[model samples]
Target: MGLISEVLLLPLAPVRGSAWAIRQALREAERLYYDPAAVRTELARLEEQLEAGEITEEEFDQREDELLDRLEEALRRRGATGEGTAL
Candidate 1:
């Protein structure tokens, strides 16, 4: 049965492979986006930019809020998944 199914589905191999690749890419992207260390690094860079006058206070506030939110979400996700305590 397995051999017969594989033979029948051989024509769809390319589609299946593409779908798998897409899924893997998405997973990797999500991992990086939700990484706590990466979020913190971005936050630090944002602070540096503010201190250097590269960004206005308003802009800094807005971007800082977004980064904090991402950090909160990452921690929450880690807690939910029992990945250990927050950093």
Candidate 2:
């Protein structure tokens, strides 16, 4: 099964995180959605967690999806920045 598909086989997961990591990941993910390197890093981490049974595949998938979605939104936001407009 795929990552998302495998995630669907499990019950809802509960995760705990530091506020710092959450904010940092969110910021990084915005520009990193389609970046293969970023995706690979996250995927490797998720895969390791799953392999260790620290997190289920479903949890990994959900997190991955969230990151991707955030990235897409970020790109849209970035695109909306018109030419040479100072923020």
Candidate 3:
């Protein structure tokens, strides 16, 4: 006697391309904003360093200006529309 068995199987679609495409999309997003939290935190720390005498006032001012400019530009590019005050 022969017995027949049947099983329900789900099809697996290709997700390799999806993963790459997602990564590419994320890279594009990051290129615009990159990381606002980290940038802001570092900028605050630079200010603190100046306050604590770790960095000279002139050095602190220069670095802070550079970081602020970059952050504002990135924010504007990300559609924050110059109102990127916080969060």
Candidate 4:
């Protein structure tokens, strides 16, 4: 039965493989996006941009808020998953 089912499903292998690859890529992207260190680095860069007058105070405030939200979320996720103790 197992052999028969596998043979029947063989034609869908490419679709399954593609779906799996897409899921893996999305997971990796999410991990990077939520990484605490990367978020901090981005926050620092945003501050520098403000100091350089590349961005207005309003823009800095908005971006800083977004980065803080990301950092908070990352810490929350880490706590939930017991992945690490540090943010």
Candidate 5:
């Protein structure tokens, strides 16, 4: 941008910086959401909850399906990007 543009936009620098920080945080959150290891840990926790009588069989099945779906998605994403561990 030209010097005049930069000078005019200087007042919005903090807003720009805040937006960048929010984007970065969301990116990391999404990475973790699609992480295979994290999904596995969640699966284990769900099993424990079921065994401990904290959840019903129906609930367990539903949540298990969701977790497995996430695992599949994570695996697919990994395969597509050729990054991270595979299922």
Candidate 6:
């Protein structure tokens, strides 16, 4: 950008910096969310929660299905990227 444009945008620098930080945080969050190990840990936690009566059967079933789907997707991603051992 030209000097004039940079000067004009100086006032918004903080806002732009905040937006960049948020995007970075989201990227990291998604990476962890799709990690195979993280998914497995979540699955175990969900099972434990169900056994503890912390969640109803319907809720458990729904969450379990979602987690299983994530697991499958994570495995597929691992195979495509060669980042982790496929399940």
Q: Which lDDT tens digits does candidate 6 get at residues 4-64?
A: 9999999999999999999999989888988888889999999999999999999999999
Q: Could you give the candidate ranking by TM-score, starting with the highest?
A: 4, 1, 5, 6, 3, 2
Candidate with more favorable, higher TM-score: 4 or 6: 4
Q: What lDDT would each prediction earn against the true structure?
A: 0.93, 0.65, 0.72, 0.94, 0.94, 0.91
lDDT of 2 by residue, 1-87 (tens): 699875885453333345567888998865566454565577678778888999977898998787677555545565676422222
TM-score to true structure, per model = 0.90, 0.39, 0.54, 0.94, 0.89, 0.71
- For model 3, residues 2-44, the per-residue Cα lDDT tens digits are 2222122212224656778899999877774546676788898
Query: Relative to the unseen true structure, what is the Cα RMSD of model 4?
Result: 1.2
Instruction: Name model 6 segments beyond 4 Å from true.
Output: 49-57, 79-85
**lDDT measured at residue 56 in model 6 versus the true structure, 0 to 100:** 92
Off by over 4 Å in 5: none
Predictions ranked by lDDT, top down? 5, 4, 1, 6, 3, 2
What lDDT does model 3 reach? 0.72
- Least well predicted 10-residue stretch by lDDT in candidate 6: 78-87
TM-score result, candidate 1: 0.90
| Top candidate, metric TM-score | 4
In the order shown, the candidates' Cα RMSDs to the true structure are 1.3, 19.1, 9.5, 1.2, 1.4, 2.5
| Candidate number with the higher TM-score (1 or 2) | 1
* Model 2 spans with C-alpha error above 4 angstroms: 1-44, 82-87
